[model samples]
Target chain A: MKFKTFAMFVGPSVFLMLLFIAFPLVSVLLNSFQVTQPVFTTQEVETCSAGFLTQNCVTEVKTIPVLDENGDTVTTTEWVGFSSYANVLGGQRFVDAITSFDLGALLRIDFWRALRFTLTFTLITLPLVLGLGLAIAVVVNNATKAIKGPVIFVSLLPFIITPVIGGLSIRWLFYGDGIVTVWLEALFNTDLSIAANGWAIEFLMMFYRVWHVAPFAFVIFYAGLQTVNQDTLESAVIDGASRWERLRYVVIPHLMPLIVFITLIHLMDAYRAFEEVIAFSSESYRITLQYLTYDYLTPDDAGNRAISSASASAMLTMVGVVILLAAPLRRTWQEHRGR
Target chain B: MSDASLPRAMRQPLSLKLASNAFLLVWLLLAAFPLVWILAMSFKSPVDAFSSSAWEVLTGPRTLSDGNGVSIVDIVLGIALAWLAIKAATKLLMPMTVAEGTLHRIFNWAVVALGFGTLFVIGFFFFLPLVAAPLEGLLGPLGQPILGITTEHYQAVWVENAFYENFRNSLIVTVGVVTVSLTVGTLAGYGLARSGSTLAFWILIIALVFRALPHSVLVAGYLPVFINSAEILSPILGENAPTLYGQPLAVIAVLVSINQPFTIWMLRSFFQNIPVDLDESARVDGCTHFQAFRWVIMPVMWPGVITTGLFSFLLAYNDFLVTSLLLDASNQTMVPAIAGYFNRETTTTDQVEAVAAAVSITAPLFLLVMIFQRQIVSGLTAGAVKG
Candidate 1:
């Protein structure tokens, strides 16, 4: 295609992306370094009240947001560099917790607590999703032809389900007096509060993620399995390789690229985990980095939002994702260059 | 391939087959049971829906006494109608519309959907009762409640709570996103695929990075701008410009941009598969570049376009963060509206209604998967396996 034609064809899409995606990214980076607040001014007010038999008058100074001519609150923006980031990092409390070597106290800080859970959640579920997906793919590959379609269809339900709905569905199964909870209580002959316990909730969140994501991995791996080299497998078998050995040597090597592909996508997605926090209602005990930004941005009862802090947290999250993608991204770049 | 055709060494042993099947059964249960359980929960009264005993939830004896029960006749007829409707929609309505060509397809789909919906409403609400009332009188004992089910929760959600407004909002956002993304994406994707410049490669890489950013980051960036949008637009629109903060339009713009990268990548891969000879040959016949693209390339691109469009639809539809944060109460989508039902304390009945609302949203998705299972599967694997 001619460069002019190419430009013409891609112009609208490029414009939309620049105006929305690229612009917001730059805005977020800048906003993290600045603070915006309603300009407040102190004013003196006098009040008169009838108290029983006497009228009392008092004067007090109050701080209020100044309103402009159009009745909108006047606001001021200033360069604050890393102050917002410091605030999000828990300024003095972070230093104290680190100096005292108190891991528990460190986690009490929202940023550290969220970072701990998000990292663990992403790393833990990566292996489970991979393992379960591979197992299902292997088993289903060997199943009779009659059952393959139904198995694939049934397996896809969790993947296709809306994330919030899927999370809520699992939550309902283990929530208070829920079916699984009731069954477990009867089996163990003890009271079991599944949702109240932090570890159990964490386990459920991981379990739900693996269950939700494994199907995606399975489908991709299953497709990879179809093109596996039968000649290599047969040659390995002729050389007296066991079933597990043949798989280890032959099948896995063929699927390595796909494993890396899935890993990259999974890491990108799981690092931004937000739905599980809401679906499980874990805000009180557990929160992810994405949710932390949302919390900062959410308006309080007084309608005050920490926009600067939210920007800082968002920047921190984007940094985390880019770090996770670094290796695979370099590999992709190299491969493209080679091509 | 069948087991008999495989060599003895390649075949699975009998014990392994049994264990594998058993494992698959367990997994299938894990994957599918929640949807089935939730579907069951949506129909029962609050007492039965949340009961400790599974059998109680299934039978709903409390619901029967509340005069909201289903006789054997109702159950049989209801299942029959549901099965028939699904069959007709998938096997008949879908292909018929596809045959109607591009411009008319949307109109045909709307007609089929609205027609089926009206039929179901008439059948379930009026026709079923009219037929069952006389039959119940004829067989006194047999007509009594065999299984308890109720539509009250569904009524509360769709009618009393006005969840249809949210559904409409969701429809507007998804439709707007899919249409705009696919339109722009196809052009950009074809352009990139045919052009082998370094700039094209660099653009794809940048898009990949953009695709990976957390949605909340973008929202935070959009938040301050949206709040001040009215003032920003006042000079342009002569002082009556509306704030974009609480509108569905804002969600659409953000979602489209978020979805564009994936859409272009998928479509570009699809376009790469089409032999360039088709369009080149058209150009050789004196057709302009745009003419060749529109007349020659687009006809073969429908499958890819539909597949990309399905994914774009899913992203817009499944989104919660952008929609919930950007849109206000009156313009909330179904997912956030359902979340609102449980965000605060509510009665048991209200909780059940929320369950009903959750189930309601899944129905359209179920139909979508049923009709386009092939497209969805291919679309997913296209990125992973082919690209």
Candidate 2:
């Protein structure tokens, strides 16, 4: 195709990406290194009628760069290098906490707290989501055909709801005197509030993440299951291989690429976990990197936002995500090239 | 223990089957029960839903209520029973072949009608009343407890909270996101398919990077532009131009960009698979480039386009991140607005209404899946595995 034809086809996307994605991307990098605040400048003015009585009556009145607040002159946006990053990432505080070896003190910082949970949530749920998805897919594939459609439909319902609503539903089930809690207490003959304890809350969130995301992997794997070479399966059966051996030797290898694909998608998504934190109301005890960025942007008293810090945090989160993505992406690229 | 088995119990080793059943059962509960529970809870009165009686809402019996100072219960039940009895009589004759004679065919049709009619009668009089009216009796309509059902919370959410406005906002924003993403992404996908330029290849790769980048990082970037949109546009539109911030248009713009990577990924191969000779021949026949594309390529691209469009619609429809952050109160979509009902600042009494709102927000999603389940299942792995 001619470049002009290409432009007609590709130009709009480039312009959109440039305007929306690329521009914001560059802005984030820039904002990470800068800060904006109300600008002000000092001006000298003569006292009302004192100038008539006394020569040389000059008093300083704070004048705003654009607008004044409470008669105090506010300044325009100013560039500050790395200060916002330091505040959010806890430059000195992080180092001090590390050297002192105090886990509680380290987690006392919002960024650290969020980072800890984000990492734990991602790493822990990755295996569970993959394992559960693969298990269900393989079993369903193995099951009698009559029950498959209903099973798939029911299994997919959790993922069908958006994560927030899914999280909320689970949250209510674990909330004060909730049915689940009520049953547990009744069965165990002891009182317990799953939502009240940090560990319990984290476990529930992890479980919810797995429940909501596993069906996606299951769909991918189930689709993959159909493509498994029946000829190879027959050979394995002739070799007197058990089901476990067939799965271990034959099925897994075929599904390897799909497993990687699911992992990549899950890693990218899990690293940015936000909706669960909001849905479960877990911010006080647990937060994720994405929610930390939101917390920064949430307007504080007097309507001042932590935009600068949010910018720094966003860029930092992107850097972390890119690192996580690099390996799987490279593998995909290599696999694509081979194909 | 040997492969031959120590006994009949151990003959073939039932462990995997047992394990599979247990595993499947656990996931079924994990995956399906919460939504079912929520649906069950949404119908209960706010008092019963949150109170210790919450469990009763599911197990308790229900009954039809009086209407306009008169009970229509007896009439409805009489009709339902008659239909059901006819259906039961037909069940015994279900094995009869319709091809045998007119009598058999009539019996078959009667069975079908009675079966369906019984269901409709029971649902209309018993279930619909529970969802749409006030109820009071010794036994609530369906032979359940007197306080088994209520429609007040659904009313509080739909009518009192004006959720329809939020629904309208979601529709507007989702439509915009779908349209813009499809249009621009399809164009770019076509380009990528035909060009084979190293530049185009790199662009696709770069877009994948953007795709994986979380929305918050991007939200941080968009904040400045939105806050200063009016300032930026004053010189261009000559003043009084509405800022893009807080507009459904802005949310759509961001969503379209955010969803483009996947769209391009989906459509590019579809575009490439089209016989290039068709486009070439059309061009050779003196068709303009754009004309050839419009006349030739688009007609053949409908299936892929439809698949891509459904996904785009879903991306915009299901998104909570960009919409939650970018849109102001009046601009909030259904997902965010549903969450807004549960904002910590809201009172405890609104909890039932919040759940009702969740049910309302999710009802369309549930319906969409039921209607288009095949398309969605196929679309989920559209990019993951190459055909």
Tell me, by DockQ, which candidate is best.
1
Clashing pairs in 1: none
- Segments in model 1 whose C-alpha atoms lie over 4 Å from true places: A50-55, B1-3, B7-10, B83-110
TM-scores for chain A, candidates in order? 0.96, 0.88
Please, what is the TM-score per model?
Answer: 0.96, 0.83
Lowest lDDT 10-residue stretch of candidate 2 chain A: A66-75
> How is the predicted docking of candidate 2 categorized under the CAPRI scheme?
acceptable
Per-residue CA lDDT of model 2 for B130-168, tens digit only, reads 743453354375433333555667788889889888889
lDDT per residue for candidate 1 within B183-254, as digits (tens), equals 999999999988898888888888898888888999999988898898889899967888999988888888
* C-alpha lDDT of candidate 2 relative to the true structure: 0.79
Give Cα distance to truth, residue A203, candidate 1, Å. Answer: 1.0
What are the DockQ scores of the candidates, in order? Answer: 0.74, 0.47
How many angstroms is residue A89 displaced in model 2 relative to the true structure, after the best TM-score fit? Answer: 1.4
Off by over 4 Å in 2: A40-74, A329-339, B1-19, B52-54, B60-147, B272-289, B345-348
